[model samples]
Target: MTLLDLTAPPSRSDRLTALPVAIVGAGPVGLAAAAHLVERGIDVVILEAGPDAASSVRAWGHTRLFSPWRHVVDPAAVRLLETTGWTLPDADRAPTGAELVESYLLPLARLEAIASRLRTGIRVTDISREGMDRTRTRGRAAAPFVLRTQTADGAIGEVTARAVIDASGTWHSPNPLTSSGLELLGLTDVADLVTAPLPDVLGRDRARFAGRHTTVVGAGHSAANTLLALVELSRSAPGTRVTWMIRNASAIRLSSSTEDELSDRAKLGGRVEQAVAAGEVDLVDGFEIIRARRDGDRVVVVGSRRGEVVEHPTDLVVNATGFRPDLSMLREIRLDLDEIVEAPRRLAPLIDPNVHTCGTVEPHGFRELTHPEPGFFVVGMKSYGRAPTFLLATGYEQVRSVTAWLSGDLASASTVALTLPATGVCSTDIGGAGCC
Candidate 1:
């Protein structure tokens, strides 16, 4: 099937233009990369999984990002907007997902940087090296990187490019509920409870949970945002009781700016510290969920905190733990992965939480993951290396590093050797074990 024509095909002169860099996903990071490549005289073809920009924002369309508009907009994208005489929004004002999507993402996609090369409703199912073993292909050898995609029409095809960048974002692959110690509350798999094209909340189903005990799990901004939304839902729907189950006794909330550490303290303090101040939400800290079961109409949750174990009853449960890169599609490929972060860890000492490696290390214990596949780069929150910070500033740095590496504009890839700290067990304490 043919992909939807978001824009007309490039003319003969345009076709003779530079081979477009293939960018996956249309999130802030991907859009930013496209703008950057365009400035460098490189054409770009963006493969976005969503129907359009801001579909993810619309997922929780009603929720506001803890980070302000300035923090989320990519610099390259900003430059393009400036070129078009578009004034940037105030950085201080908190922007909701809907507002961000409508005011920025949608407009950018509709603009020149995106209009011609954008392909919405197309999901990149796989990527791998592709080239003719013998010969007979246009322009040098086959690019070695073939992107397999499925369009909305159910048509399947492939596109080859000189380089590939994965900016698929993180929300698509949510951390498994069981991984966080929460069981399928009612012998019902989390999948069954989840509806495709999942919306953040159910207005009609809102009454069902009224006055019923509901639990929200996780310690990140996403969870915090969800909790905040539920708090508002409980104000008028007072019967809806809310409880937050976090592995860390305290929730770690992030703000837009890091101008001063204290500034972050106030913002994080506002939503997390102050929000908890209200007695409406119960905060269960210092606990890891161990099991979940359906107790008639309610679900029972078991967990351990500090040195003690406890149980709680709830009518509904959501595990907002987090997500990692779904590189499993490339499992057949033998690629070098970081022992620490387990991602294709780059040997560079770059600090970009928008990267997948950062998010992977938090749960999996790996550092920046990298591979020898030249001209290939992956960016965005998925690259956060397990220590998912979910910050746009980190994403900016990621694009900068990736673009430099891809274009061969950097002097050399950065590197540093790290020694693991002692684990308390002495060499003598072990049975003739050697210590490094």
Candidate 2:
């Protein structure tokens, strides 16, 4: 009944049978993993940290995804949903985060196979072998994984599984405002003035920016979204101002949207271009922010610009700098992560932002996602580590292959069946700005 008991064998010579796979995070990829594994008759248990599925996605519910329904919805999940007579949304129409949850993830979670196996309001704190630490190797592969979890009521519990897939994304961890990738000095003092990367600016959070001079940081799509929202807010609420800052010498890096295969992504670049041309948003180029402090009612942002110290005083700061994976939880698990990207060593090159564009990155499966640990994988946006070129379609393919391998379908696991659209641009300088 317990995970440790499952590891106990009739004899040392007998092969250990695989137990149910435990998936952390109930976002799109995590739920898709459940769908695929369940279809294969593999027992699955999903642990979600929030009250419902796609909690992180719900946080930025207002923003529309660049990819349409066809790209975001996993095929395995669709098959499961179809059995229940679920109606599919428009394949070509892009849905906002809210629509994604309501129309797809929500309905998929309601399936009898998934709903019964899902445990909401549970956070997975740590994962390791039942009887072995990272230092011990004897019987390690045979021992089931022990996941330490915390419930909403503050109760601690443990669940054991034959395999683990970390689909927990990087949304909760945003990069710091500093150009050095570290926290800005004196950031805590003015932290109250900073907003999340994707705030509901046009909705509930409008009053916060209506008539204030807000400075948006970073060069990614999230930043672009915030800038556009601020521009819209300024039109209705005069006296509202928006200032854009980036470490890049110029905003030309964002010009790639014009050449992107996806029309929605291209339109984002066009909108930003028009905003800049019309002087609707102020551009602060080459601004390497290094420090922050509160100045009376305003926050003073201090940084260096071309060897000279520069300061910008503003009422609010939106830190749209991207996110990084939380690796601390897996410290006791053996992970062969790349030195730079922090992704699996074999997967780093294919997704390296320095060389491959989003589309150019080859289709990968179980081999690329595997770690030194026998039955553990990092998928979804978390698998990309610091690289910013992840797409929902990529994560769907990942779980598909991982589930196949878990179910003993070696042939299906080895076949790379994913194809993605390219950003039409590649650069190492893609620093935290762009769609996931």
lDDT of 1 by residue, 194-254 (tens): 2212225435456655666667776655555556657777777768777877776465433
Report lDDT per candidate: 0.56, 0.81
Specify the highest-TM-score model's number.
2
Q: Write the per-residue lDDT of candidate 2 for residues 107-147, one digit (tens) a residue.
A: 99988999999999999999999889998977787788899
Off by over 4 Å in 1: 1-18, 131-143, 179-209, 252-278, 295-297, 303-311, 332-334, 347-370, 411-436
TM-scores vs. true structure, each candidate: 0.74, 0.93
Q: Largest lDDT belongs to which candidate?
A: 2
Candidate 1: give its CA RMSD in angstroms. 11.1
Where does the lowest 10-residue lDDT sum fall in candidate 1? 427-436
TM for candidate 1 is 0.74
Residue pair clashes in candidate 2: 220-433, 220-434, 221-434, 359-422, 390-436
**lDDT for predicted candidate 2 compared with the true structure:** 0.81
